[model samples]
Target: MKRIAPAAERNKDPILEVLRPLLRDGATVLEIASGSGQHVIHFASVLPAVTFQPTDVDADARRSIEAYRAETGAKNILPSLALDAASDTWPVHSADAVVCINMIHISPWSCCEGLFRGAARILPAGGALFLYGPYRFFGVFTAPSNEAFDASLKAQNPAWGVRDTDQLLALAAETGFAHEETVPMPANNHCLVFRRL
Candidate 1:
């Protein structure tokens, strides 16, 4: 059965707008934590030349991705894979770019560390790693809503909360990536673009 994420539906277009200029023809994009498969399908439909490889840690999410792929018959979407960001080994060997949306804030810090490490291993020099989510910068929350959301996330799981941008930049640097730019989105969320160096 297909599942829908309202957040994914709402943010897809804005995310695509940021991705449009970065991604090139025939680029292989590996998406981490592809929750409902909504974003991948939408991106693939618009960017037919770029192949999207969607992965999720949960089986249900993978099923939803496959369902969306079947419904859309999108040729650029590869079969969804079961991938855990915290794992040292990844199923795919390489990609031109890696995209992770709404994941860092919800997972443990170790997962974020592993994400950078794995991305660095798979992406060649100059490869892009795009991250989208609400974030804190130098101990400041961008919005009151984000502050509240962070509190709620921690209340749910102590490990989960909005991450700090500076910390992520440091981690990226340690993992052979350079912080390129951060684009603010509609909500308090931001799109962080990094390049493998």
Candidate 2:
């Protein structure tokens, strides 16, 4: 059976609303960790001018993304590629924008650090790097659900937990990407946008 991430269904449109204005026309958008490929097909179908490049390190996930691309007949969506956000050498070195959804909390913290370095390397001046997921702002915002989510992530992997936005900003700044904006999303989440400085 095919898998589904409920959050994808929930947030894709809201994200698209915010992304519509932020994304430049005819720009190339690289989506890291394109888990089920649902968002790529939907985004590509909706935003025809912006090219969507979906990527992930997992072979199975890549196949899933490819399958969706073929099934949906999305011409604007590029072929899926193997891209581990923790790597310094991405297959494609240049993109107008890079996006990652729901990855930072599930993967090791090093993945976020690598994402900053990679975004810094690939994005041009004024290019955007977007991240969508739950975040704790400076160790504040003590919602019970968020606390439970954090505990669950830690239980699964010692290295995994929802990130703190201030810490993330520091890392992004270190990698030459400055914090630009933050958009609140449904279900205890946020869309953090940064730009290459």
Candidate 3:
């Protein structure tokens, strides 16, 4: 069986552009909500020195990750693990960096809170948490498409909508992460990088 992440095709290169400079040689990165495992396998293929440990809560996704890893023969891509963003217990305790893409808006806001809390506990001082997704800023939507997307997401789940960058920063602050940089990407999405303070 085969699987794929819909956004991986469009966003991986852009995400990598931001990640390449930030990623240190031989650093361990824990990828959250690794749907289809496409990102992990693609990234690991390019960055053999950097170890990528992919995690997803879904069993089917885990199987897809394994399938991709096996097909790619990428050693730097570690076996996928089950990780629930809202759960107190995570599969791994520490990582040099954490990457999550397109998760916050699809799930309840508490998941973001939990993600930051877990990052606080696991990230060493100066370690980074990189989040990629569409977001609002200053109570304003960045794009009309984003506004429509937010409306659709809310229709699906009231608690799920594009988060405000300021709100997210505040939440990260509560979890001991200081804002580092905000990069603009294609499709009105933003890449927020925060360092453990």
Task: Give me the candidate number with maximum TM-score.
Answer: 1
Cα deviation at 174, candidate 3, in Å, is 0.7
lDDT for 106 (candidate 1): 94
The residue-by-residue lDDT of candidate 3 on 1-197, one tens digit each, is 55976788889999999988878998999999998888888788888899999999889999999999889889898899999998889989999999999999999988899899988889899999999999999989999999999999999999999999989989988889999999999989999999998
Best by lDDT: 1
Worst 10 residues of 1 by lDDT: 1-10
In angstroms, give how far residue 124 of model 3 lies from its true place. Answer: 0.6
Q: How far off is residue 81 in model 2, in Å?
A: 0.3
Candidate order, lDDT descending: 1, 3, 2
lDDT of 2: 0.89
lDDT of 1 by residue, 1-197 (tens): 89988899999999999988889999999999999999999999999999999999999999999999999999999999999999999999999999999999999999999999999999999999999999999999999999999999999999999999999999998999999999999988999999999
Give residue 27's lDDT in candidate 2 (0 to 100). 96
lDDT of 2 at 25: 73
Mark the regions of model 2 whose C-alpha exceeds 4 Å error after superposition.
Answer: none
In what order do the candidates fall by TM-score, top score first?
1, 3, 2
